[model samples]
Target: MTRIRISSGSRFEEEIGYSRAVIDGDHVWVSGTTGYDYAAMTIAEDVVAQARQTFENIAAALAQAGCSLDDVVRVLFIVPRREDWEPCWPVVKQYLGNARPASTLIHAGLQTDAMRIEIEVTARRPA
Candidate 1:
């Protein structure tokens, strides 16, 4: 199997030495994506907005891997505040409703208070 890497051009990728996503054969594995917009280098204060941006970031990485949300087979969501999860559900549904991937959510400390959410996904090209 051949391996390919996708970079989102985020400074962290260089500093931490990690790709945004990796494609190995037909499988795509995306890193934990935060709400910070790589181009804008900004994050929204509202949790819902952050959630939406998180998915957008993930989507971009998936596109680079020649996959889409529909290809996702598993998802993981991390939020510092449990209450914030409900507000982000609609945004999550808008992007992932069709995929209906197996998912898990956890409440935990994040790197910064500004970051409200982080998402990670694994996808496989349909056979």
Candidate 2:
């Protein structure tokens, strides 16, 4: 099988030597993605907006890997503050609720205070 690496043009990917997502055969693994709008390089203060942007970013990466949110089999969410999770739930449900992927939420510190959420996902292309 050949390995394909997808880049979101984030400076950190090059600095950290990591691809945003990698595809090997039918599987796709998207790296932990933050809420930063790569084009504007800014994140929203509100968690809801951040959550929306986060999914948008993930969708783009998945598209590059020839998949979509519906193809995801698992999802992981990281939040610096537990309280912020509920506020972001609506957006989360809007995207992944129907797919109902195996999901996990972790309360942990992120790289910055402004960064409230980060999400990572694993997907498989149907054979």
Candidate 3:
């Protein structure tokens, strides 16, 4: 088995000393990802919009790991405000309903106030 590190080019990864995701054997573990559009470095104010962007970021990372959202087996969601969680349901379903991965949601402050949602996931590449 070989270990591989994937990067999203987010400055935080370099500054914080972490890879966006790591591929160890058949598993892909993505770091807690925020909604910032890495290219533009901007995040939407709406939690729903942020949720969508967060999934996109995760999808990109998964893609780099030779998998997709459908390959995800576990997911964790973190939101600063509990109320914001329900509003993001539709976006979550839209992106991850197929995989229906085991999931957990936690209410906690993020690295930045502007980040309404942060998502992390674990996936396995198809055998």
Give the best candidate by lDDT: 3
Spell out the clash pairs found in candidate 1. Answer: none
Against the hidden reference, what TM-scores do the models get? 0.96, 0.97, 0.98
16-94: candidate 2 lDDT, tens digit per residue: 8999999999999999999999998999999889999999999999999888999999999999888999999889989
Task: Write out the backbone clash pairs for model 3.
Answer: none
Model 3, range 1-127, lDDT digits (tens) per residue? 8899999999999999999999999999999999999999999999999999999999999999999999999999999999999999999999999999999999999998998999999999998
**24: Cα error in model 3, Å:** 0.3
Q: What's the CA error at residue 46 for candidate 1, in Å?
A: 0.8
User: For each predicted model, how many residue pairs clash, with residues at least 3 apart or on different chains?
Assistant: 0, 0, 0
Per-model lDDT = 0.91, 0.93, 0.95
Model 1: which ten-residue window has the lowest total lDDT?
118-127
Sliding window of 10 residues with minimal summed lDDT for model 2: 89-98
| Model 1 alpha-carbon drift over 4 Å, by segment | none
Q: Give the residue spans of candidate 2 off by over 4 A.
A: none
Clashing pairs in 2: none
Q: Say which candidate scores most in TM-score.
A: 3
Overall local distance difference test of candidate 2: 0.93
